[model samples]
Target: RLFAEKITGTRRDRPELARLLDHLRSGDVVTVTRLDRLARSTCDLLDIAEQIQAAGAGLRSLAEPWADTTSPAGRMVLTVFAGIAEFERSLIIDRTRSGRQAAKAKGVKFGPPPTLTPEQITHARALVDQEGRTVKEAAALLGVHRSTLYRAFNKQEPTP
Candidate 1:
């Protein structure tokens, strides 16, 4: 039986791939034209390979002959490659974290801009604190949710 995925290899939820894996019997070899056609990343490839192995089936890639799980040498090579891929992914994560930290130190703000300006927040607080208006009324006047106004008030430091 042959299985082909119509969706991009980047997605792991391919119906054909699932059906193929489910139908696999012992001694069955699942073949792909290339390793990239099977998975988006090395981790994804390893995960799929593990699934195939668990189902008592073998995986083979024509473009990457060393990726075959049928032979001991091929299995060893795949394991080594998986290790390297994991290390590379960790390095990438570390670099990304460092970049974000550096950006933060430079005063770069992340996430959506504040819903209300400082003046609007102050006015809202006054409406609730000084004018004795209800939080819901103030929020309605400001065109924001009551919870948003509450959070804004909670975040502000007390005035001396």
Candidate 2:
């Protein structure tokens, strides 16, 4: 009997589940207390069910009778659920993309703030270019890594 009770249902890296699937043979039935106990999401559930079917094994959920993959009707229901899940995921992706675009239009930044300001970058560049100070020395004066100073220098336009 494979048990993954300690692992959270949201995690996909259950060792016991992997072992059970790996050892499954033809005509084997993998019984679970519930469908949620076996998979994190509908997509994950369908993927595991597909693997079981491919191995000629079936899945049966004690709490969800309709989840049995050994019967024709059960297979049909799961297939329909898979289609719905796919459609829902696509809709979510589209909505997220639209929302991100809207946020960008409003001048909302997504990632972390810049490490150094334009003034600091200009000062660092002047120390390196005009004073002939080493990149390392300039970065040390600016209280930043040489690479950070270098990145700042690269991003700004070269002085005429």
Candidate 3:
């Protein structure tokens, strides 16, 4: 019986798998129960296969007959699919960037709006510093978090 090492972790973040791959030698076959169990995505799958091939090793999926990296046809098919997946990801990124640019051109702001306006912040700072009010008191009057009020005050203060 062949002793198979059981590695546990998300396929995307398996340090053990990476170490195993690095130590794999020629004639070594890395076998997995399933294709998805080994790779998080098709691109990741192809990259791992390329690494194995570069190291003179092969990959085999028990559940996926077509995912055999030991065969030329399987390698070609996997490479083609990975290329398609990468192209799709690039298209998605381009569309998202263009969309964000269009929104920016129309004065759309990203992230949460400020909890308190600049004038409110200034007043809050005055209450805490000039009026000798506690940070908690000033924050309560401004209807903001104490940390938020403190952050605004810190930004307005000049270092001694």
Taken over the whole model, the C-alpha lDDT of each candidate is 0.90, 0.90, 0.80
Predict model 2's lDDT versus the native.
Answer: 0.90
**Model 3 lDDT tens row, 53-155:** 8999888899988888889988887888888989988999999999999999999999988788878887876776689999899899888789997777667
- Using TM-score, rank the candidates from best to worst: 1, 2, 3
Root-mean-square deviation per candidate? 1.8, 1.9, 5.4
TM-scores, each model vs. reference: 0.88, 0.87, 0.61
lDDT by residue for model 2 (4-79), tens: 6577878867877888888999999999988988889899999999999999999999999998889998899999
Those runs of model 2 whose alpha carbons end farther than 4 Å from true positions after fitting are 2-4
Which candidate tops TM-score? 1
Which 10 residues in a row give candidate 1 its minimum summed lDDT? 151-160
TM-score for predicted model 1 compared with the true structure: 0.88
The reply for model 1, stretches above 4 Å from the true place, is none
Residue pairs of candidate 2 with colliding backbone atoms: none
lDDT of the structure predicted as candidate 1:
0.90
